[model samples]
Target: MSLFILWGAVFFTLALVFYSVGIWNDYCHKQLKKWHITMFGLGVLTDTLGTLLMYLHVGYLIFTAHSISGFLGLFLMMSHFCWAFLAIRNNDLQLLNNFHRFSILVWSFWMISYISGLYLGINGLG
Candidate 1:
């Protein structure tokens, strides 16, 4: 269930990134080019990869790598959210500025909580 939540968040974040960038490009001089798109894809893909890596661990050594990758993925996920919001905010692309801001905050909070929990779990405290 928690894994579902994490993956769900990742998918939602990816969708938001695509939508935000598409909207921005269409509305603001068609600026979101191939490079940005490719980078964004790689970032999200790496994030998902890291999550999967975390999911594969069952012991200390693997768990450590998993923990590190999980945190890295969360960081990348955060970057994606921030980038999407910033692009929209920069262009004043207010499809839902208030909503986006609220969403970003929620995502950030969740990421922090998730990472903290993973930290404790890795340290045998969970």
Candidate 2:
């Protein structure tokens, strides 16, 4: 495998481990909100598949899917982070109601970058 594929695989594996940690945390903690934690697992699963496909040198499918998924996962994660912080600050859920506003903006930019990267990589332009 090329370096990129190997690196991608490694990265994906790392993400899987991280998400697994989140799952364990959720299971053990029992009281935290769960949407973002679930998102982590789903994200890790998708990304792991994507990275494995990359290792196999499959083009486009893994690249595009991973690109979209990574952005979505991170978007949820960012919202979770913001929510946690805001909850600490205001002791309320009001800020979380609007958390998506910032997450959308960040996700949009990240998606664009991921799409561009996938296009270049899949087209042999990377």
Candidate 3:
């Protein structure tokens, strides 16, 4: 694998871990915290960086179905993160909990992108 692929793998792995932490914190802990917000932000940022690296490596030809879905997933995750962050900042716990319900869908989309990307990368399809 090339350096870009290797680094992408590393950052995406971190993204997965961070996202998992955020989801777990939200669902299991049932409490919103600064660390949870940080984790979500970090996950999105890392995932974006990793995706950018892959895009750079393959140029426009890398715009596969998986990549498109991955970008959409990243967008939703970021939006959800921002929603939760703002809700917390505005002292709206009810809104925060309401947004927490969206975490499952966020996690699902993220994992779909992750699995699709993994498949593409492993099969040299990207």
Candidate 4:
């Protein structure tokens, strides 16, 4: 594999770890916290870096299922992060408490994209 692909994979894995920890911790605690928001931000940052690296390696964009899902997942992740920021900023108790449901849904969709990318990568179809 090229160095770009290797580093991209590493960053993507880091994104997964960061995102999972953030979302699952919030879910388990049943509350939104600043730290969780930090994690979500890190997840988005890492994912973006990974995506950029992959794009550089590929030299162009290809509209495939994996790519489409990845874009969607990234969008959802960013939206989730923004929502979390808004909830925290607004300090709405109900919103903070109930945010886990949305977080989990977003996380699930992100996981689907992640897994699909993995499968495609393994099959040399990504």
Pick by TM-score: which candidate is best? 4
Instruction: List model 3 lDDT by residue over 1-126, tens digit each.
Output: 888889998999999999999988788877788888999999999998998888777776455678778888989988988987888799797787666678878888889989988887789875
Q: Which stretches of candidate 3 lie over 4 Å from their true place?
A: none
Query: Could you give me the TM-score of model 2 versus the true structure?
Result: 0.41
Candidate rank order under TM-score? 4, 3, 2, 1
Off by over 4 Å in 2: 1-3, 6-33, 38-91
Query: What TM-score, over all chains together, does every model reach?
Result: 0.34, 0.41, 0.92, 0.94
Cα lDDT, model 3, residue 9: 88
What TM value does model 3 have? 0.92
Q: After superposition, how far is residue 122 of candidate 3 from its true place, in Å?
A: 1.7
Q: Write the per-residue lDDT of candidate 1 for residues 11-87, one digit (tens) a residue.
A: 53454465345434433554444454454455456456545544543323344543554565456555655665466
Per-residue lDDT for 66-114 in model 4, tens only? 8998999999999999989988999877767658898999999999988
Superior by TM-score: candidate 3 or candidate 4: 4
The alpha-carbon deviation from the true structure for residue 91 of candidate 3, after best TM-score superposition, in angstroms, is: 1.4
After superposition on all C-alphas, the RMSD of every candidate to the true structure, in Å, is: 10.9, 9.2, 1.4, 1.2
What is residue 99's positional error in candidate 3, in angstroms?
Answer: 1.8
Query: Which clashing pairs does model 1 show?
Result: none
After best superposition, candidate 1 residue 66: deviation in angstroms? 14
Candidate achieving higher lDDT, 2 or 3: 3
lDDT of 2 by residue, 28-86 (tens): 55433555445554544555555555645654444455456565655555555555455
